[model samples]
Each structure stands twice: as C-alpha cells, then as structure tokens.
Target: MSEQEFTKSLTYAPGLPKDATFYSGHKKRVTSHAVSEAAENALKERGVAVEDIAEIVFDLQTPFMAGLTMEACVENVRGALAKRELQHAILVGIELDKLAEKKMLSEPLQSLVDQDEGLFGVDETIALGAVSSFGSIAATTFGYLDKVKPKIIGRLDQEKHGKVNTFLDDIVCSIAADASSRLAHRVRDQEERRLPKKR
Candidate 1:
C-alpha cells in the first residue's frame, strides 16, 4: 500500500466516517509529532527530562508485561503522548500546576492548590480523564503509580523540585498507565495472531 493509504488505514476507526470533518483545523495541529513536541516541552519546562519520564514508564510497565523491552515501553509512552486527548490533558494539567505554583488562583482555591491540599483533588481528576481512553487497566496502573510514587515520580513531588507538581505528577502517571495499557493490548493482539487456526 502507498504511504498515504497506510496512514489512512491507521486513522480510520469503525463507525467513524473517514470523510467526517471534526475539528479540522485543531485536529491537523494534533498530529503525533505535535503531541510529542508538546509533551517534551512541558517536561523540560518543569525541570524533568524526557529520558527520566521514559525510564519511569519503563520501570512501571516492564514488571507486569513480561518480555517487554525498555525500548518498547518508551515507544508506548510516545504513542500515548500522540493521542490528542492526552496532549490536551497534559497541557491543561501543566497550566493548572503552573498557575498554582504562582499563586495566581484566587481565594480558597489558590490556597488549596498551592498547599497541595489532600482534599483538593481536582488536579488528579482532570488527569484521570486521560486514563479512561485506554480502559480499566490504565486506571488501575494510575492508581498504583499514585500510591507508590516510584522513581522520578517521587522526586517530582518533592518540595526541592521548586514547584508544585500536583497536576503534572498525576498527568505523568496517567501517561505511563496509558502506555502500559497500550502495550498490553498490542502484546495480546500479537499473541492471538500467532495462535494456531481452528481446522
């Protein structure tokens, strides 16, 4: 197949008309390249490296997904980052975190976000929306990451990071969770394809 045909095949989903125009302009801007660039820039601005984020994702996913390579895990993270909804979530979450860091919000809300108040969980809730796209496994993985705060995630949450990462941390966790779920699905598909056909 031609490259254009391959690209079209990948993007076409059942029940969604290929010619349907939805957010034509915005969707054009939401390409995989754009999403990856946005994710990288957001991480860099927060004093976190993409490598560190990828490493955390690798560590979080490899244990559950046997035979999954670090490279594959990293690629899955990139794929997760490519989703337009996920890109939007990352941008919104980081903007909220920065606003909270600067105390730009008003009244009790400002105080709640700045202090990382336990009861104030709107940040996580926003991040959770991104996790739902990949199904229940993504949600469970996110819950695990939230509770464990492993590796780079723990560091990002520290006061020494010089910023409130209340939203960013959850956003990262959701990314990793989504990536893990994606990898699991891909692996299962491969395995099923390899099974012997019924006579």
Candidate 2:
C-alpha cells in the first residue's frame, strides 16, 4: 500500500495503524547508506563532522595499524555509523541533548541531563550500548576516550553554547571506538590473507 494510504489507516486502532504487527520499514528498508547519511547529518547539525570522529579513530589505531590513512579511517567511521545500533544511539542521544538545550525536558530530570552531573552515568551507558557489538577493544577504547575526551569530544563537553552534550560526547566516543575496532579487525583479516596457506 502507499504511504498515505497506510498513514490514513491509523483510525483502525486508537493510536496505532490497523496492522502494527508488521515492520513498517519492510517496504522500503532503511538502508545502511541512508542511516549513514542521517547519522552524519545529525552530527553535522550539532557542529560535529565525520572527520572529527575519524581523527579519533586514527589517533587510537595509528600506532598499532601501520599504513593507515586518514581516508581509510574516515571510511571506517562511516561504515561503523551505517550500522543501526550506532545510528539509533547517536540519533537518540543527540535528540535528548537538543531537548535539554531548549529546556523542554521536565524538572529534576531536566536539571540532571542539562547539568551533566558527575553522578549521571546514563550518557556513558548509552554509548557503551552502541559499542557493545564491537567487542572488548571498542569497550576499552570507549572508556579511554570517555576519560580523555580527546578532540571534538573535549570541546563538546566543555563548550557552553546553551547546549547540553552529556550524551552526544559519549556517543561520539563510542563511534570512534567502534570504528577503531572495525579497523583492527580489517587489519587482522588482511594479515591472515597474506599469510601462507596451511597444508
């Protein structure tokens, strides 16, 4: 059915469409490329660029992965964000941060998110959730980046532009961590390919 038709069918149920059992995206699956574009756009809107995240990945992996170019790092960063988990995490975190910026969130909860209280660990938790699929390397790198807040992350966390970046900074860190981990795995694959075949 057409999008308009499907949308009009919402009256079948009080709040949901007639057939909520199916995946809405099945007709036009949300492609990785689409997600990549959206994720990058979201970051760009918030003054963060794909290169900003790529720089972190390069810094984290250059010592271990020789001949690693900035272009390669950037591609890997894009590749990582293409995954639904990273896309969702970054989008959700950024939205929350924007909400806090507008002071649209409720009290107490709003204060916690806006102030970025030291005790508030939910930001890191959301970031870790995005990095979890990448394995121990991403997890550890996320922790390291959280502590250092290198590059754009540092600026984001410290900048006071009426914007609350409690979740955004961590989300960026997780993307870098995940990209670094993906680069590492790709390097491993390249090494295995070069090795002599076992008899």
Candidate 3:
C-alpha cells in the first residue's frame, strides 16, 4: 500500500484526547476555601495568625507586580493552596518543622532542625518544590523574600518567638512567591491581549 493509503487504513480510537484538559480536574475537585482554612488552622496552631500571614503575602506581592491589590494577592494564595500538590507540601513542611521544634526527630536530624543548621537544607528544598509550580518568577520572588525576610517571616525567624518555624517561613514565602508570579503573568497576559495583532 502507498504511504497515504497505509495511513488512511489506520483507525484512531474514539475517546477524550489526553490534552483535552489543560489542567487536572483535581484543581476543581478541591476547593480553595478548604485549602485556605486548613492552612490557616495549621499556622494558628504554630502561633502565626492568619492576618499576619496575609500581611506578609501582601508585602511580598505588591512591590514587584504593579497595581496588584491586596485582595488579588489573597486570592492568588488561596488559588495556590487549592493545588493538591501544594496543599500536601504545606502540611508536610509544617508538620516536619513542628516535629523538629518538639525534638521528635532522632539525634543528628533533631540537632539540625532544632539548631536551624546552615547545612540542613531539606526544609527549603521542600518549599522550593512548591515554588516551581509558578515558573521562573516564583523562584526569583522566593529569593527576594528569603533575603529580605519581610514582616511575619522575620518575626517567625526570631528566637524570641519561641516557635520553630524553619519550614513554615520558607513554605509561606513560596506561597507568596507563587502569588506574585501569578499576578505578573496575569498582568502581562492582559497587556498582550491589548496589543494589536499583525495581519
């Protein structure tokens, strides 16, 4: 058979194409409200107030992205939380930090977490995984937030706070970083859409 005839003889399966859905339906299956509530409860248990976290999120987002409102930042964070992967990361990172704070880990590991060792990079690594969801802007934003340690992040890092927030700080930073990236992408898309197209 000729190449054209051979190709025509092949039958395609009839079903939904794999690429039909850009995003997994899981994002819709999980509610952002539920995710936000769980995150708030977790933070509260660790002595960080939801309001304080919101403030920090606002601080991280506004400086880089122009005209990004506080409400938008809050919504972005809620949206990020809605991702099941991020939700799992946040819970696991927080719980691991709590365990370290309570001295629940064995010898060397406990010492690393309790002392906040410079070499102990697991916490930041875990948080980094979540940041990647939003692309390169998220990474750069996370670096800035990590360096500045603005607002609640700084408070959480201090020894006087009496709470070991090793992972919590980084996780929150990732959330804020993701939100900032989201805003940047949205604004850029809007601008692109406004531009005239060539014939």
Candidate 4:
C-alpha cells in the first residue's frame, strides 16, 4: 500500500476522516459527576478531606474576597474538583504517591517519590497542568501554596507518619489554588452584576 494509505489504515485517537466509522459507538464514557465523586473519594481515602482543601482555599482568597464564607470556599472547592482535567490529575498524582507508599515503583523513582526530592518537580508539573486552565491567578496561587505548605498541606509533607504525600500535597495546592481562582471570579461577577442594579 502507498504511504498515505498506510497512514490512513492506522486506528488511533481523533481518527480524522475515519472518525465517523472508526470512533463512533455507544462507548462507555464517564460522567462528570461520577468523576468528581471519584476524585473526592480518592482524597478522602488518602486522609485529605475536601474540607481541608477548602480551608486552604479560604486562606488564599478570604482576604481579597469580602464576605466569602467557609461554605462558599467549600463550594468552590467542589467546583474545581468537578473539572475533568483536575480530576485526572488528582487520580494520576495520587496513584503515583500510593505506589511510592507501597514501594510499588522501582528503584530511583520510588526513592525520589518517597523522599519527595527538592529537584523532583514532576509533582508540581502535574499540579500546574491542572491549575493552568484556571488562568494565571490559579497558577500563581498554586506556586505560592507549594512554597508555603500551609495547614493540612504542611502535615501531608511531613514524613513522620510514613505516608508518602509527594504528589498529594501538590495536588491539594492545585485544588485550593483553582478553587480560590473560581471564588475570585465568582465574587467579581457578583460585583459586576450589582453595578447594573445600582445604576
């Protein structure tokens, strides 16, 4: 077969002109709600409650966001976790940490993950990927949280408990950062809406 025909014969993602025939079906796709629930459960299983993450969000946003209640901070956390990309990051990052905890990963990777080496930046990379979607505010907030390691996040980073939280800490940073960004936008939108009423 010609090179073009050979390329067309391959069945991969997107599938171009062959998508209608190649990728069409009643495929079993996960629901957004289901993914959100799974992400929440994963956090809970790792002893990192959504409420704990919300506290971080509250800390990050409460100053700039007037009248932002803890309840609203928690709601924003759920909103951030509902995102599919963020959920994927949570699942993958947590799985890596879990593997390190159990020593399932091999050799240097296991050691690096367990120790959470200063130079091992993969954890931050995964987290930034999730937060970057929320814009620069969320991305910068993630960096700040990563640096500060406040509250529950700081506890997770402590190794005395024998829990490997290399990725979970950063994952928490991403969630809190994204939620704070969401809350910031929400508050700004509410203010903008009120302006019309005032006028």
Candidate 5:
C-alpha cells in the first residue's frame, strides 16, 4: 500500500467534552514530518503502525488541581504515539468529576501542586506525563494530537485512573476500539497501494 492510500480509510471521531473542563480529540493530521518520523520510530519500537492501529483512547478521571482533563488526554495520546513512532493517532478523553469529589483527591492534590515537594499523593510527574504528550492547544479547553489514529497506546493506567475511572474508562475503551479498526483499514489500504503497478 502507498502512504496516501494507507490514509484513505483513516477516519477520526470528533472530540467532545464530557464536562466543563474535560475534552478529547478524534481526528487525523498529516502535518509535521518530523512528528511523523517520531511516531514511526515509536511504532517501530513497539511493533505497531498508525494504519494498523485501531484507536488511541484515554480517560482523565483524576482530580484537577490547575489543568484541564482535555489537555491531559491529548498529551497522553500524543506521548503514546510519539513513543512508538506510529503514523496516525486518535485521542479520546473522558471525564469523571464526581469520582474526584468522592475520592477527595482534589484539595489535597491541589495543595501540594506548586510545592514541588515530590511527596504528597500520587505523583504530579505521572499526571504531567499523562497530559502533555499531544501538545496542549488551550489552557484547559482544547488541544490536538500531532499524529493520526491506529496509534498504540503506551501507558493506560498512568493515563487514566482505572481504579476510580470505571464509567469513563469504559467509554474510552469503546472509542479506542473504534479508532483502532479505522486505523487498521487505513494501513491495509496503504499497503495495497505500495504494490508495484502492472504495466
């Protein structure tokens, strides 16, 4: 399959907001060759490709201190793809504000946010790594993944709080499955195009 052909069936779902601050991405972009190379490298390392990928889904059900869930999801998606060097990436973000309140990881998490003390709760670095991979486009509202779908998810647990993100993760997993299928078809098409032309 050829490159463009590989991307033919690559369809992306539009990102939607699960709540006020929670947002997600569902699209494919062909810009940035360097980013593409990075994705490709990452994919090679992971033994996957954008065209072969089904979807790149992530859920952010953590207690927000000063950032947006949308931003975090995008970053996680991007970081996952970049880590593998895949071609396409799809970012799915889910919200779980209720859980945050119930768990009470909010105020305490926020208190130590700026301290940089490195000892309070779960780990800010983990959260940052989870949300900054896809290149944040907005303060806490919008962002975009540098790659397309068919991306292999690198860190799932770190990306979303599975223990507390049940509902949100369920939806995200569904979204990821859809994206993965679409990406795989795209990859198949590209492979077909790569075949030599018969004269």
Candidate 6:
C-alpha cells in the first residue's frame, strides 16, 4: 500500500486524556481500549467497516509465522503461541449470526461500528483492543469467531504469561471492551457540563 493508503488505514480513538501516556513494549497496554480504538479508526479510514470484519481470534497454541495472509494469519498466530508453548486460545467476534439470532447481546455486533451508538458493549471494544495489540491476529481471530459464534469464549490459560505478570492483560480487555462506552460518556458529560440549559 502507498503512504496515503497506509495512512488511511489508521483509526483514532476520541477522548484520550491530554496527559495519558503510552507504554513502550506494548505487552502491557496491548489489551487496552485506546489501542483498539486507534486501530479500528485506522481500518475504517481504510474503508474496512467493523461490521464487515469477521472476527478477532487469539491462539497461543502455536508459534508465530511471518508473512501471513488472512487465513494464514490465524495459523501464524497459533504458531506464535506454539512457540511460547502457551496452551490457550481466545477469540472475540465483532459480528456473528448466532448473537443476532439469540439476541443474547444487548445489540447486534454491528452497533459497535456505529459511532452514534455511543459505546454500548464490550464485544467490539475487546476485539478492537486485542487487534490493536496483536494486529491482524485479533481481527482474523474475531472474523473466525464471528463465523462460528458471538460469545467471547476461549481456552483459559493464565499461566502462559506468568513471567510477564500484570493485570494489564485484563485491563487491556476492559479498556478495549469499554473504552468507547467511556468515551461516549465522557464526551456527553463534557458537553452536558458546558450546556447553558443545565447550568
């Protein structure tokens, strides 16, 4: 892709605090919502709608492979996991038929792409954050999950990243899943506070 094309692929998250800081290695904040929002904004800018995206799956059951296509990306990710010999898989779907059919989730996953929705749920947020941290692995994983189901299920293996310990992984997930929700609230709150009617 050209520079413009690449630039168009980036998405920016709204409402980043002016004093907010970014981590260096990304392992800590990889799962954060800010990263996810930025990535989604980038892809949308590139014309890839969040709704159009299939899934965001993470497989640490294998080693990471280089030069992967969308299909290969999953395998490569699995390879990355295998390399670490991690024994778990996490998948988050952005849009899935089953979720829409069961109506288990508050809104169809598509609502995530709707900026007007003002942040509703964690489905898209988590997936977006994981993708931001892990790149296409998260997106394709989500795509794969969407093809199968909507529930963000995975093989629980907390022991894998024990050496690099921190609740940051959990934090990242929370941030991604709820960042937009918080953003919408913050924006609305800011606006509300500024309103003469309320004052």
List, residue by residue over 61-111, the lDDT tens digit for candidate 6: 113323323443333333332211111112223233223334444644434
Q: Which stretches of candidate 1 lie over 4 Å from their true place?
A: 1-36
In the range 36-71, model 1's lDDT, one tens digit per residue, is 687779878887665666777678667777776778
Q: How much lDDT does each candidate structure score?
A: 0.79, 0.89, 0.74, 0.86, 0.33, 0.32
How would you encode candidate 2's per-residue C-alpha lDDT over 1-199 as one tens digit per residue?
A: 5555443322334667545534344356577777777888999999998899999998999899879999999999988887888998988899999999999999987999999999999999999999999999999999999999999999999989687899999999999999999999998999999999999
Supply the global lDDT for candidate 5: 0.33
Comparison by TM-score, 4 against 5, better one: 4
- Residues 33-64 of candidate 3 have per-residue lDDT tens digits of 78767876786787765456557667765666
TM-score of each model, paired residue for residue: 0.79, 0.84, 0.74, 0.85, 0.24, 0.21
User: Candidate 4: which pairs clash?
Assistant: none
Instruction: Give the winner by TM-score.
Output: 4
* Off by more than 4 A, model 2: 1-34
* Per-residue lDDT over 130-185 for candidate 5, one digit per residue giving the tens place of the 0 to 100 score: 33433332112111221121233323222433233222222223323333333334
User: lDDT winner among the candidates?
Assistant: 2
Candidate 3 lDDT trough over 10 residues, lowest sum: 3-12
Candidates 3 and 6 compared by lDDT, better number: 3
Per-residue alpha-carbon lDDT of candidate 4 for residues 1-199, written as tens digits (9 for 90 to 100): 3333332333454634655333223346577788788888999998988899989888777778767789998899988988988999999999999898899999999999999999999999999999988999998898899989999999988855668999999999999999999999989898898885655
Q: What are the clash counts of all predictions, listed in order?
A: 0, 0, 0, 0, 31, 30
Q: State the lDDT at 65 in candidate 3.
A: 66
Where does candidate 5 have its weakest 10-residue lDDT segment?
138-147
